[model samples]
Target chain A: GAGVSQSPRYKVAKRGQDVALRCDPISGHVSLFWYQQALGQGPEFLTYFQNEAQLDKSGLPSDRFFAERPEGSVSTLKIQRTQQEDSAVYLCASSLFGQVIYEQYFGPGTRLTVT
Target chain B: QQPVQSPQAVILREGEDAVINCSSSKALYSVHWYRQKHGEAPVFLMILLKGGEQKGHEKISASFNEKKQQSSLYLTASQLSYSGTYFCGTEFQGGSEKLVFGKGTKLTVNP
Candidate 1:
């Protein structure tokens, strides 16, 4: 079976620009999550979606950061007004169920940089 | 909230034993251990519930302490393949699908 896959493995944007990172979750996975990993740091939760509904977005840093999973299988994380401080690796993960007990399968991630 | 992991980094010799600890400020429902090699996704090692029971994964066993709100990973007879960053993930109450991960501990296993 194919694992979660992300696109644009690398993205470079100008300051104050907008960028969209895409994630294709494994087929039928009900839980999808996005995380941000800064250099030399651990991955930090960004947002989560259960099916087509986003259950949580408390970890999203600011209004400029938005994520959506419309059809429940694919997700997109968009950052508006990107800043140099926003440089980091964006990761996507999916699990069989919405339960936290299940092991999450992660994508290779998209490295976003703002210059 | 992020958990606290001791010995932010450690070096070990092959066949030696190493222990990594994770502690949380709040009560947790479960603890998950994962290892991430360089340029690779994290691989789940094991998960331990609040109970005193210990879960073993290929000679790597982990135990959760309810009283101390902490957990420890025991790696016996370490191998070079074990060189990677170890992370401890904590699941809070309510099963909200949020997992807080530690900063991770870098372990370098020497031959």
Candidate 2:
């Protein structure tokens, strides 16, 4: 039983460039979530998906952020025209069945540095 | 809105006890507690549903007061391994499943 995993452990991007971070949820997981954590702060929700349907995106900071879970297993978070403020660690999590009370399994996360 | 966590930071000696509190301004449906070590993803500790159920894990336990929209995590005999940042994520009643998290409470346990 592998846990959730994220790719590109670290990414350095120039301001205004676009970057995409990937996540692989646990097998058979039906709920996936994305969050952003800045230094010295808690993780802030970004978006969520339930079986490929984007259920919640209200937590997204701005229009520049976009995410998708096309296959209901893997997901991607894309940031357009990245700003220095976008520099943070991007985390992905998943639960077995999208249950409100299910404990989410988290990925190692991808640290993005906008220079 | 994000919940507020008390005692932004705390220091404890091994075998001591500590409490971390989280409060929300709105009605809550569920509360989730998580711990994250430096450079690592947050690890789920326990969750309390709207029923105000109390849960325990090892020497760590938590109680949720649904009526007050607050939750408290209690750690007894704190271990060095318990040193990390604790975050409380709250799901408001009538809100989507998205969780709004508190800033976090940093706990440092020394031998």
Candidate 3:
């Protein structure tokens, strides 16, 4: 079975530019999560969606960050204004169920660099 | 709060054994383990739910001490393929849907 997939494995954007990262979850996954990982650190939670409902967004750093999963399958994380602080790897993960106990299958991630 | 992982890094020769530990201050409902190589996605190793349960995967195993809010991962006879960064994600009690991950412990297994 195909694992989670993220598009544009690498991206480079100027400061103050807008960027969008896409994620395609597994065929039957009901849960999706987004995380940000800086160099030499573990991933930090960004947001979570159960089906099409945005269940948790507290992990999002600021208002500039936004995410949506309208069809309960593909998800997009958009940043209104990119900053040097946002330069990191964005990871997407999906689970078969919406519960916290389920294992999450992660995508290869999209590395974004804001200059 | 994020969990704390001990021994920021470790190196062992093939066939050697090593242990990695994770601890949290808050009450935890479950602990998840993952292994990630450079520039790759994290691969799930196992999950240990509350009740101090223990689980195993291949030559690797883990134990969760719910009372102590801590978990330990044991690697027996480590293989070169086991070299990577090990992370522990903690899910707190009270319906926390997100995982707070630790800084990660890098394991290097040399043949």
Candidate 4:
């Protein structure tokens, strides 16, 4: 009955530092997605996974961003050498059947600040 | 590409009505509507599939004009609780797993 959850509700990193955000999807959710939301803007898709496979990563902003869902249940998004431009809210969502028709359940998201 | 949303923002008195529009340049498979309050996750409002489908949620409803590659979200008799940013997510014909969101329309309802 639990919804999606993310860790480190808030994170502050110095420029050039590295950060990792975690996402715990609802039980048995087969599809997971990550998005980035800049201030006053709609969320931008970053990556997506089906089961344990990273099906879509085209939306990732750069090579420095990486994501993994090795077990198909939990996922982690890592950023190497963070910059002020990387500051944003990182959101995670999951769906029951990996279908676009099903509504997604979103997490509270991790707000990352780069200074 | 991100869909375009009109009127970047809107302000209305309680019990008034509002309409938000989303238009895309490419063919779409489905359209999704979401509402997000400040510092919170987006909550799903409804979805409209291709073929000009219409769906309703409480006092809010949406219509998709597949032929025109556009969708409209209608909220009548607005309430304070409806104050938030509204986003329209478009799923293109070939990309079912991803959604491209519009810039969002800020809605403020005053009592």
Model 1 chain B TM at: 0.97
Best DockQ among the predictions, by candidate number: 3
TM-score order, best first, reads 3, 4, 2, 1
Ten contiguous residues with the weakest lDDT in model 4 chain B: B94-103
lDDT tens digits, residue span A49-80, model 2: 99999998988999999999898889999999
Docking quality of model 2: it rates as: high
TM-score of each: 0.96, 0.98, 0.99, 0.98
For B58-104, candidate 3 gives per-residue lDDT tens digits of 99999999878999999999999999999999999998899999999
Cα error, candidate 3, residue B46 (Å)? 0.3
> What are the RMSDs of all candidates, in order?
1.1, 0.9, 0.6, 0.8
CA lDDT of each prediction against the hidden true structure? 0.90, 0.94, 0.96, 0.95
lDDT tens readout by residue for model 4, B1-111: 799998799999999999999999999999999999999999999999999999999999999999999999999999999999999999999865899999999999999
lDDT of 4 by residue, A1-115 (tens): 9899999999999999999999999999999999999999998999989999999999899999999999899999999999999999999999988777679889999999999
Chain A TM-score across all models, in listed order: 0.98, 0.97, 0.98, 0.98
Interface RMSD of each: 1.1, 0.9, 0.5, 0.8
DockQ of each: 0.72, 0.81, 0.91, 0.81
Instruction: Tell me the lDDT of candidate 2.
Output: 0.94
Clashing residue pairs, backbone N/CA/C < 3 A, model 4:
none
DockQ, candidate no. 3: 0.91
- What digit string (tens of lDDT, one per residue) describes model 1 on residues A24-103? 99999999999998877778999989999999999999999999998889999999999999999998989889887888
Q: Which stretches of candidate 2 lie over 4 Å from their true place?
A: none
